[model samples]
Target: MTTFTFHGGAGEIGGNMLLIDSPGSRFFLDFGMSFKRHGEYFSEFLQPRTSNALGDFLNLDLIPDIEGLYRNDFLSHNKMKTSEEPAFDGILISHAHLDHLGYVNLLHEKAHVYASSVTKGIAEALDELGSGSKDDFVKTTKSFSYYENKKGEISRIRNCRDPEIKYSQREYPLTVDRGEFEVGSASVQIFPVDHSIIGASGFIAHAGGRSIGYTGDFRNHGSRPELTRAFVENMASSDLDILFIEGTNIDEEKGMSETDVGNEISRLITEAEGRHVFASFPVRDTFRLLSFYTAARNAGRKLAVNFRQAFLLDKLDSNKALERGKDIIPSHDEGLSVYIKKREYGLIGEDVEEEEKARDYDKKERPYVGIDNQICWKDVRDNPGEYVLFLDNYSVQELVDIQPVEGSIYIKSQCEPFDAEMELDWGRIENWLDRFGLQVKRAHASGHMSGGEIAEVIKTIEPKLVVPMHTQRPVLFSDLCDCEVLIPEKGKSYEF
Candidate 1:
């Protein structure tokens, strides 16, 4: 018997947790957070209680409440049942996007992770560069443990104080080859697919004599459409029993290609003439970053990025998986430079004392602080036309220091605001743009397949059953797919 359960991403866009049970195997596809559900209860100031172990998350129904599937330390701390072994064989992460692999930290250590080498590198960078909580993909932090103090009193262990007791390094086996690998009784193969992120992939699993294919957020309009084309060709010949496809942009008719985006940005930069150009884009989307990079270089301007982006770029460049795909800007490129922000007490510049400026940066940021290609706000303010500044909402305050001139341009190379909170943030961004008298332009390419594109893929694959995951319009797929389209309910199991 073969079974499939939709733990998350049933009728939603993200939080893609799919449980697959076969003759002798049980595993999950992804374990991510639902942005829609999470936003309903928490905000920046209000968050899940770390001291409560997994109680706050399980009680609030944020994570699935399944026995023997989580870490022993958290379960024991909360007085819940602890299992010596993990219930599932392992988890196969398709990419490093938060919508796909955010909550992997809560799973048991034995449920090892399998992903491409580039995905692993990006996950490590996100954890190291982000806040200490919630982004621990490379290592799961040990929490809610207790120890005996010197005076013989029981005291809770602090991870910061005890360096050795802080984290448990999770096992990650790289999926580098095309051969089938075993996760308990199931045979699995992961193939690289083109998406917005660097190392996105899809899965093919054979369990209980059934062959299944899962498309984990793919696209055909990016810089490298050949990857997706090869994935479709592989599925066309697999004779798949079932196909789990993503329909994130199933409602949209079409989207621009990466070349189109680059062309538009090049035109914009050329017209910016003696004024500065500021662009906002997703930091991890290397294709989009390359578009901006190419545009700036063609227009005789240098591209400036924040320290965090520089760190992630370095990691991506070092990964060998990216070598065969779209090229990442070289670290030694003269057109690329790191933009330093004034932090802590806001002391910066060559005139400031070295000790005073050093206090502004954390230890991780010190390596790239005074490098050869580092640029400060004054450098950008003085030579407006010589640089294209990559600035996001969190760093918008730096605009006040740079004071961009009246005729400058601001290119938004990302998606539009989707929810109310993002809409509010866009309003604030407009206020800053208005104060500077800058013109705003929009140019971006989506990272998912459109409605017609997915329909073509369904027609090409010709699977017996097409189950929709990571989409809100599962019923819409019925009109597009010739095969049986199963609309799965959240937490319900279906057997074949």
Candidate 2:
């Protein structure tokens, strides 16, 4: 018999933890941390772990211990155990998204971890770019490794229960077979799927004449839509007993396709009076970048991207349009006159030469400026006409420090969480808008499928049982499909 349990990500967005046990072995799908509420987080800083780490435990109902599930002792150094300690057989990382793979480093060294080749590359790249917090839960057993230096202070945190023990580093094969792997008595396959980020995937686990499918996070459109469709069709014919799907856009009333959203953003940029600043999540979606490129080109304004965004574009050398240098602006250009926050420049790299490369442009040409917080005020005073500011969720408030003139707009080019509980800053965004008088517009499309598209996928996959994950409204499946919607509660086991 095989049993499946939902440890986290049951009815929430983050902290996606799932446990699958078959015969003598068990494994985890994902383990992530959830953001806490506003007041709760503030109180948590005053007393770490004592007060629930910003109410994440309370909000997700995670405070109460679930019977039969292992405690998250892997999160702390003091409570860590040796390899001989009880642990899962393996962990399957579906993709490189922080929410999906965040708590992965928590696994013991003896446990195996698996991901696709492309996904592994992206994950390493993220660590190189200083985005290694996703794996903070894991400890480093060796001194010489790509991630050793960065794991310095993190290794010192005290473990909760066991004071004498030290945690081991996470160990896994560089790449795993996408087709299937045996874990105890069950077989698991990794299915590639299209999403905002490259190399995202779903999973198919089969055992005892029953099969289950898990869609990590996916979209049904864009360059890889066909691949996604094919995966769905293949799963449909596999006689699967259950399917776990993601319903990220379940509550969105009127969502546009990626192509349409791109066109709309282009229109907005075309009509803008000044230079355009676009803050985007630079992932696998080249269409969004292309849309910004087209809009800037049509408006006769240079498209300026931060060093991190530029690096993302560089990694995607596969895109012919971006590679040909159509409308994209290289990071280091002198005489380029747009000001960006200085702290953001740190993402490029630590090397002084590499940092200087962004500023090394033709001095004879028009000055294109990148500004840090201290110098941004100067750029605003000197080059107000040449700048249009684009703000992401993280740096939106920086615009206030610049205080652009009336006609300038702030374009939000990503999905804003609808659930207030899930958002990090509540009402802070509205307050910022009110103070700046900057017109705010959502010029973004999701990287996940809509209700209709998810329904189409269900029909195509045709699994014996349908389950939904990574969604707030899992009940929506009741209206879309005829299969059994197995809404497993946290730690509640389902046997096959």
Candidate 3:
């Protein structure tokens, strides 16, 4: 018999942690931090979990009560015990998204971690870059093992045949002792999948005469649709017993395709009279960037990206068209040249030219060419008709403060939570726009599949059981299939 438990993310969008236990082994699908809700129990005083705050997990029900699961040194001051079972044999990370990997810092040294090579790289970079947290989520020297295939005896036999053969395999492998670990008598395999971010993957675990499939956050519209399809086909071919899938778009209407969204953005940029500024989640979909590039080219205007945006694009292997610089504003003499912000100029030092430094020239010495300003807040201030801005949720308020000239437009191009309880700040954007009478447009595309697309995927996979996750409405599964829609509550167990 096999038992499954939902510790979190059962009916929520984040904090996804699930436990599976079989005869000889036990494991966790993910251990993630929950985004604090306004006025919620832990929302008021919750800070990033520090070594000193391990006791807070007990009060907040974040971490489970697993005896000997974690090292004693990692615990907080006030240690309390719960009736919960011991920790699992290992942890399987599906991706590097903070929501999916946030709680990793809380685990013990004994917990083996697994992730794709690119996911691991990005996670390490995030730790080094210090975007949100200052400390590395995963310890630097901490050891982890990687699994490429989910097959049982065949995979093990292949590993034993030749040590050299294992090291030379296509996938990245971290050397570890397999005999030291067993998860509910099941072997685990991590399979790559398509998502908005690079290096996302799904997971397959085999145990107790059954196979379970967990599709981590995924999208079929990215560059790897066939790869996503192949994963589903492989699962269907393998005859999976139960499949856990994300349903982020289960309640959203069918959204525009990536291509359509790009075209709409292009149209908006081309029609706008003032300077254009765009702020978006700068990951995946190089096609969107290309759309902006093409539109700028067609309009005979230069493209401009912020320093962080330029850095991200360069990391993605896209730097051919960018002009390295130390200023947000471009030279008044240059024709259609892309300008990067100068705030983090030292970070990318020596590579940028001295002449590109807008700060070098004295205020009175700088030559002013109105039309030559490719990118600049000052350009927007002096000649708002010459630039366009693409703003994100974070920068919307700032953009509102700019108070652009008449006929300026703003476009929102990503998913914004519509829940009344969430009280997202974007809701205020609408009211602000109404107050200002600014012309606002919504030109966006979804990263996840629509209802019809998800239904198609379900039909293609044809699993014995379908478990929907990552949405407010898991009941949507009832519309697609008559099979058991197992909505396992937190801490409740389901047996097979």
- Best candidate, TM-score-wise? 1
Off by over 4 Å in 2: 36-81, 129-134, 137-169, 174-185, 251-254, 275-290, 310-340, 343-390, 397-403, 421-426
How would you encode candidate 2's per-residue C-alpha lDDT over 1-496 as one tens digit per residue? 7777887777666556787777666777766544432234434244334323313443445432332222244223233223454356677787777777754543444556667665655554454454122233333222112221233533433322222233344455634425777765667788777677666777887755567777888887654577688678778877777787888776655466666766777677666666324444444344565566556656655444544454444444443323234323333432122334545343222246633735543332113333332124345534544443444556665664566666656666766656554364536776776677766666776788888888878888777777677777888888888777877576677885
| Model 1 regions more than 4 Å off | 131-133, 146-165, 175-179, 330-332
Clash count in backbone of candidate 1: 0
Q: Rank the candidates by lDDT, best first.
A: 1, 3, 2
- TM per candidate comes to 0.95, 0.72, 0.71
Residues 181-293 of candidate 3 have per-residue lDDT tens digits of: 23547777666676656667787788777789888787777545665787787777767789888887887667776667667766777787455444353433334544455
- Preferred candidate (TM-score higher): 2 or 3: 2
Clashes of each: 0, 20, 15
lDDT per model vs. reference: 0.85, 0.57, 0.58
- Tens digits of per-residue lDDT for model 1, 1-496: 8999988899999999998999898888988888988888888878877766377878888788998888887788778899988888888888888888988878886678888788888898977876544667887666666666667777776625454666668888755824568887998988888899878889888888998999999998998789899989888899999999999988888889988999999999999988989999998887888888889999999899888888888877866666622557654468898888888887766687776687799988888777889888889999999999998988888888899986899999889988998899899999998988879999999999999999999999999999998988888999997899999999999997
Question: Roughly what TM-score does model 2 have, to 2 decimal places?
Answer: 0.72
* Over 4 Å off, model 3: 36-39, 42-51, 68-73, 76-87, 131-135, 140-185, 273-303, 314-376, 379-390, 393-403, 420-424, 428-438
